[model samples]
Target: MTVLVVTNDFPPRQGGIENFVRSLCDELPEVVVYTSREPRDAAYDATLPFPVVRDRTSMLLPTARITKRAVQLLQEHGADRVLFGAAAPLGLMGPALRRAGARRIVGLTHGHETWWAGVPGTRQALRKIAEAADTLTTVSSWCEDQIRPALSPAAAQRVRRLTPGVNTRRFAPNCGGEQVRKGLGLEGVPVVACVSRLIRRKGQDTLIKAWPLVQESVPDAKLLLVGGGPDRQYLEELAVRTGVSQDVVFTGPVPWAEIPPYVDAAEVFAVPCRTRRFGLEPEALGIATLEASAAGKPVVVGDSGGAPDTVRHGETGYLVDPYNPVAVGVRIADLLSNPQHCKELGAAGRQWVTEEWSWTRSGAVLRELLDV
Candidate 1:
């Protein structure tokens, strides 16, 4: 089937949704992508297997023009199915695409996109998308629950849960832990790595606050923060004020290719995500935590959102309160202090991801949905 995925974010641009869409393309055949971002050079466009239709419109164009361009692209592609990456803006184009020869419409909801209950127009737009689409799929069961209340009776019945899959081949256990550790200057010190955007919602500050407690017990433990964002300076200051500056190392925005190695190097991976009303905390699945687990590293994630669905509490790793730094620190220290327990937890995590979260498996599920 020819599927046209509409998304605001894509590879060359980084985020969970971007990664999810890119991985989805890797699994399916005859897939075409329409994105808002344009490449600097034309040559880069040829690199992807599918045709990348770019929409470059200035801010001057009203919402109607943008919707028209999206509809035009859907009509031009002759897509059998149109998948909106999120409910908002992209899903707003759903009715237009359906009018333009697309047979089946699917809106992919990711956490907060569907959690806009109080917003007047936003809720109405989401309801429109849900009502218009043949199917509504979310990345996690958590998201399914969030959107269910707002969905029309018929739309709620069609809503399905399709968790994001991890590329096990790219993020496997054999990435060499010692080599990655040495490369990141974390040879002797026990490393606790957090791989996410340095943002408030990600709970990096919460992790930084927890570091002092972890330090009291494991003074030599190092915190490696991967990825960068607007909250870089603020997080750095938080680390300093918390008196864990020397223990914290911020490796700003590492390439996607290098992220796996960093995950492999860590003794434990932390994702202390907080809730956002418009944005779902923990989204559907915590891809980074899954990736870290797949790399044979135990994960320490927050209790909110869809994290508990993956973390498995004591089995795979610990789930802590994102707002509480002391609990976060204590959990990190527990994993760090016991190497045998860490290995056991890491093994369990790797097993869970490999068995349940493979891209090949996700492709089969997606194909089944499209076939129906």
Candidate 2:
């Protein structure tokens, strides 16, 4: 079975969706990626186990131009099935694929892309793509629910929920705590790490607001903010105003391969995601939480979206209200004070991820849907 995966997001441009798509390509057979990014070097082609075709068109081009290039690729590759990794490219390519001789088309949804409540023409375009596709797959049940209302009865029946997977082997708890702590200048401090883009919806502001309260109890506690985005300056100001700027360290946009080491260096991980103007907390599945859990680190995630599904409250981690910074602070302090409980939670989390969220298991589920 020859499959052609279309996506704007790909490796070297790091994010959950990009990682998920790359991992799927690694496991699947006779796969070719049609991406917007041009290869930077010969290593880009040599690194990939499978063939990758780059469409060297400016992203600012009109929809018709994008559609023409995608259809041209489908014909050139003689692709049996067309799998879309995002809505924009998929919506643009849907009509073109119908015009072509392609019989099977699959569309994938993740978070905010499907949460079109009041947008003009966005819902209609999404519905059209859903109706045109033979199957629709989403990363979480939350996303599936968001898109279901936009689909026809037959289109709705084709929707399937397939959660993203983590590479457990790479993210395991192998790094020595003392060595990592010393290297980060956190030798005597309890580390509270957050690995995500510093955006409003990610709730970095909430986490910064909660840090002072956490510091009052565990005075030696340090907060590490990983990843970067447009909200960096605003979040930095929030940390200063909240009187916790000295203890906070902002490692702006670390490479994807380097993130696992940072995850292993921390004592606790927090993701206080909240709803934004776009929609209700656009998190389909918390892949970072799973990676942290696999490293045997206890997590504290927001109650909104798919976070509650990833975190098991007292068992794996704590689930607090995203709106309440005090509640989030209290949970972090409680876990730090009770080392025995923290260890137990971490152990349970690691076991849960290994059993449920590995890439091998996820690939099997995805392949079954592709029926390859």
Candidate 3:
């Protein structure tokens, strides 16, 4: 029943997919992780309950050497099942691992694979991986639709939904946000927080564009941009150019452990994520939005890809056009302006997430797929 997790997306490489894989692994009985080498990974691995074997390379491709090593690990760990954190290129090794010893193989798909399905070159490779694995799990229905077309008829039939689950206790209302609010000098200020990496597709620029309108409604409102990426400098410059630099607070990058407080401190959580690269890039499932909903914050999500699946529209939050700053701004302003409505939406969001998106439920689905 021991499972071997093969992925390049594990922590100390912080991302939505990394956390999703780690959380699912926590639900397994016995496991061993085989992932790429990352800075500070040794310390992170030491804290984990399972054994984590690191590949010398930082990024793992489906090469002969890597596949050979993966097979060795499969045999050494006596792992009967294999889970690829990201199915795409890594899942290409599934046939090899199965020949080596793995009885069951599961490959999880995130955003990129959805795009891979549409491209002619990558679509063939994606189809091969899909056919080889016992199951290919998708984070949302939109993703399943996008990927299934690239898969063979039989492989498409094996596709299953295994969405990421939120740790409700960790991301609940009143999770001690007072310190964060005081530290950020945001005490009593209406704050709209976007907890995600700075990137074009993530729509931080759109948020900056929308900020002026938000400020018009709630004069003292602040825009909190959390996490860092290549787009930080561009977003900061854009914020300045848009004349809202004074009102926007960029925390650069915050550790995952400290994200709950930042999320709790916000009056409204938003990530105006959009599809990019002419529909090749999408928001996948938007785990941050789910986490915000879990924290009892009404989210203003961008209507892109599977991100819409995270919100219940009028009930939990509002979905806006990611490209339309006016739409995004108006929804955010309305939420901040009406505290009672905000509270109601937040409470309902929290209740819905607690009941439907628990990690225990996600784990049970994984266990069933693994047949363990």
Candidate 1 lDDT at 7 equals 75
Q: Per-residue lDDT of 51-143 in model 3, one digit per residue for the tens?
A: 999999999998999999999998898889999999999999999998988889999999999889988989999999988899999999899
Say which candidate scores most in TM-score. Answer: 3
* Lowest summed lDDT window (length 10), candidate 3: 172-181
| Candidate 1 segments whose C-alpha is farther than 4 A from its true place | 38-44, 58-62, 277-284
Give per-model TM-scores: 0.94, 0.93, 0.99
| Per-residue accuracy of model 2 over 1-372 as CA lDDT, tens digit each | 777788876775678888888888876787888776544624566788777777675242227766777777778887767778775436557767767756677777777556652255877777777777877787776777778888788988988877778878888896555665677788777898999988877788888899888988899899988899999999889889988889888889988887887888788999988766646456677899989998999999987666677888889998888889999999999988888888899999999999988888878877777677
RMSD of each: 2.2, 2.1, 0.8
Total clashes for model 3 = 0
Off by over 4 Å in 3: none
Q: Which of 1 and 3 is ahead in TM-score?
A: 3
Best candidate according to lDDT: 3
* Candidate 2 TM-score, true structure as reference: 0.93
Question: Candidate order by lDDT, highest to lowest?
Answer: 3, 1, 2
Each prediction's total of clashing residue pairs, residues at least 3 apart in sequence or on different chains, is 2, 0, 0
